[model samples]
Target chain A: MIDPLSIFLLLLSASTPILFAALGELIVERAGVLNLGVEGMMITGALAGFAVAYVSGSPFLGFAAAATGGAAVSLLFAVLTQFLLANQVASGLALTLFGLGLAALFGKPFEGVKAPPMIPGPFRINWIVWLGLVMVPLIWWFLNRSRGGLILRGVGENHDAAHALGYNVRLVRIGAIAFGGAMAGIGGAFISIATVLQWTEGMTAGAGWIALAIVVFSNWTATGVLVGAWLFGGVTVLQLRLQAAGVKVPVQLLSMAPYLATIIVLVLISARQKFSRRAGGAAPGSLGQNFHALR
Target chain B: MIQLVPRSEVSTLWQFLTPVLAVLATMVAGGLLFWVMGYDPVAAIKTIFWDPLFGMASSYSRPQLLVKAAPLILIASGLAIGFRAGIWNIGAEGQYIIGAICGAAVALAAYPSEGMWIFPAMVVAGAAGGWAWGMIPATLRNWFGASEILVSLMLVYVAQRVAAWMAFGPMKNPEGFGFPGSRNLQQYPSASNPELIAGTGTHWGVVAAAVAVLATWFLMSRHIRGFHIRTAGLAPRAARFAGVKPETLVAFCLGLSGALAGMAGLFEVAGPAGQITDKIGVGYGFTAIIVAFLGRLHPVGILLAGLLLALTYIGGELAQLMLNLPAATVQVFQGMMLFFLLGFDLLTRFKIQRRVVA
Candidate 1:
């Protein structure tokens, strides 16, 4: 009695946010910068987008505000990790905490307020959904076929080599991080504006973290990111379907499916990478390491 | 042009001074934040930093400090060990929840039994539950080469869901007219963790926190395992050459931190909270991370940082009551403190120099 088309559509909607965030993280990682503040940026975007859309009566303006908000918060991470030479992990964590707090403070008024109506695009899906679908190929083209993408990969593979070649490492990473932030913000806005249609505290939940896992699951590849997001989205939609079908399992247990699935995927990917050793798509050589220019 | 130059050795003086500087910086930033939010910055700062310890309500708030600080210190002390060795167990919040559930289940099962063995059994169950939960990430990281940070954080959400399920279903208080919570553990004398003194909020948890600090200090400074942990964090290759098994260290740090976090949760449920509820997670686990960093991952430093953060919690609440400041203000303050700390931490290992432009 299960409808495949409806489930597929739901899966697409559920996966779009993760797709956007993961793609952004993929670019950042490709540039050898691991900005773990995607969650923070996403939440900030969610609130900013919701608030702006609610006040302005335009979802486009909301999405714009979300991207700006996400980028602005990410710039804080750039300042800390890129400029100040702080630990990437710690700085990213702090960014998340700061973003969460800031969003909560800003979102107090937006609580229970309905989000503005979304403009239906092709197939009656929101434009952002279509935009997300388009971005996969676009990002793939950018990372694989573009000159900027080559430089980003070169930097990630070996910052020293890139720096030796007179490339500005920090500038490239800052740009990637900002783009990642903007994408994460848009992803977060998708949740508030297109999906949930209302603002709430901590609404992004673990979607950002899931996106982080998806990047690793994707082995830093754009196509792999799409697959991973779909897999996770499938799990999310399936779990909801199971609940709707009056399964014997508790709803709480069903809710844990996506997170548990992410962990399982991560473990499998890591184990495979460990055993394969000379696998083509290994993590970036200089990922999570701060680059410093010696005088 | 100003530039940062890496030093051969970290300055001992800056190591201690950066935390103080960060605290001061947070105050200024937080004051400005309050000002922007349409409140008197001076009054808000005073309420947040001063009122909890020395204001008119000092007598009441003094004890509350220990109550607030006990879990933070306990959890942070454990977290500091793992952080020292670079084994990030960010899922202590999950461990804390499981520990509380396990401990509460023990007490709930022994409801009418007036025996000394019940509390001890609960404590053991709490620690064991946390250890078991911690092992998931440890084992995954060890065997599968997974990232503990993501795995542990993922578990937190899982634990939260499990806690919610318990509150709404199996653990719901049967005698409370369909309410979603376990029996009030505080009223159950045989299972309660009561304040040892009349006015002070001293309890078994506070004693345990103090003991943990001493124990961690001794381990980090005097023990070989602790030496291995520090060496592994500082020089992984050297530690491996010296026969320090990375797997063992990862397991030990995660397990120890998990146990401590669990004990903190158990103590909280038995003493202050008095019952297992869906909202049992008040973010002490996350806050403890900030405490661990603020204390420079040192036991003694963590103790002081715990007290300072606890002061903020109490003061934040006071501000909320008096000035109607949003509850999220304290979270922002804490986050700002960590941000400033990480930023200022640069001075410990590097010196900023103004370069001559030719």
Candidate 2:
């Protein structure tokens, strides 16, 4: 009795948040900065979006607030990693822990409160869903065709070379990190305002981490991020369907499909990259390395 | 204007001082946060940092420190080794859960059997389960160049689900109607891990933690493998030239950490926690990462860091009860501690010089 079209629609909606977050991470990674605090930023966005939408009665304002909240959180990461030269991994993890705690603390008032209604688009879908879809090609164009994009890739590929070429590495990376944070925030808002229609502590769950894995699964390509997100979305939708159909398997085991799939896909991609003898399978040259400008 | 100048050689003194500085900074920042939240910051800070050790409730909270710190020290010790070699295994929580499940499975299967062999067998099973879980990422990274951080982290969610399933399904208590959790191991004499000294929280876990600290100190300071780990992290190509295979190091570090985390879980399930429940993995694994870093990845330092963090946990609870602060305030304090720690770490490698612009 499961309708294929409805399932497709559900998958599309489900994939939008991850697509948005992964696309943002994609750009950040391409710029040679690995921000592992996507989860933190997303959670902050989720609460902010939900709280704002509830108060202002406009989902758009909520999304905007969410983006700002996420950006602010990422700026902390940028300050620590970019300006202070803290270890990127540890800084990012700290950001996540901080964001989660902050969100939980802030979200106390909004818990169990309903989110505002979403604005429908042409296909009876939320406007943000369409925005996420349009962003795919837009980001692809930005990363591949734009002049700024080339400079970013150049910075990622060789920060020293880019520096020698007179490109501002720190400024470019800070912008990229902020944009990634904003995107992650929007993605998180999608979960709160569009999908779940409510705010809950730790509700973003592992979606941020999943987005991180999807970036790797996509091999650092914008188009690949879309495919990976949709694939994961389909798995999630199908798992829910199986659970709804009174499947005998434990619900907990069924919930593990998406994560297991991520691990498996990561293994396959990594193996292929190994056999091909390429360094990091299209990873940015200076990914995760902090750039310190010397006079 | 102040300008940061990179130091030619890493400052040994700053390395030891940064953590202390970070802690003091966190106190100031945390107090400010509490004040902003409309609480008496002084009283709140005292309850969290001071009262836990010497306050009116010190008698009650003192024993809780060892109880809470035991697992942290155990897991952080293992995590520190892998972290030393740049092998990030963030999924220790998942391994910890698997270890607990496996250990509990051993105890549950041998129900009513009064034998001394049961506890030892459970411990072995627990370590093996954790080792196997840890191997997945190690093998993947070794053979395929996959990032262990993401893969291992993903496994945490999966392990959480598995733990939930165990609580609801096969491991559910049989004689206690339809409750979700397994039988209380605390009441089960054959499998129970009791406090050796009453009111002190001195259990086998504490003993194991002490042993792990000593063992790790010996290995990191005196062992050739430890030297190899340090070299690999500092200079990968140099380590390779020195005949250190990256794959072996990855496996060794991951396996060792997983085993240690697994032991922590085993000890926890067999002792204080006493049952397999859905909420058993209470983030000791993640917090251990903080302990590892705060300890500067040193074994002895982790012991002290573990105690300090445990103080926060106890003090946080005390704050929640006394000052009506949110439970998450402690989490925020811990996060800020890490943030300040990483920021302060900058001072260790660089010195600020006033810029002279003509």
Q: Write the per-residue lDDT of candidate 1 for residues B1-358, one digit (tens) a residue.
A: 7878899999999999999999999999999999998999999999989998899888999999999999999999999999888899989999999999999999999997889999998999999988888989999999988999999999999999989999888988999898889899999999999999889999989998999999999999999999999999999999999999999999999999999999988999999999999999899999999999999999999999999999999999999999999999989999999999999999998988998777
For lDDT, the strongest prediction is: 1
lDDT of 2 by residue, B55-77 (tens): 99999999999999999999999
Off by over 4 Å in 2: none
Model 1 CA lDDT for position B117: 96
DockQ of each: 0.88, 0.85
The residue-by-residue lDDT of candidate 2 on A119-233, one tens digit each, is: 6998797788888999999999998999999999999999989999999999999999999999999999999999999988899988999999899888899999999999999
Q: Provide the global lDDT of candidate 1 against the true structure.
A: 0.93
User: Would you list the clashing residue pairs of candidate 1?
Assistant: none
Q: Could you tell me the lDDT of residue A182 within candidate 2?
A: 96
lDDT of each: 0.93, 0.92
After best superposition, candidate 2 residue B149: deviation in angstroms?
A: 0.6
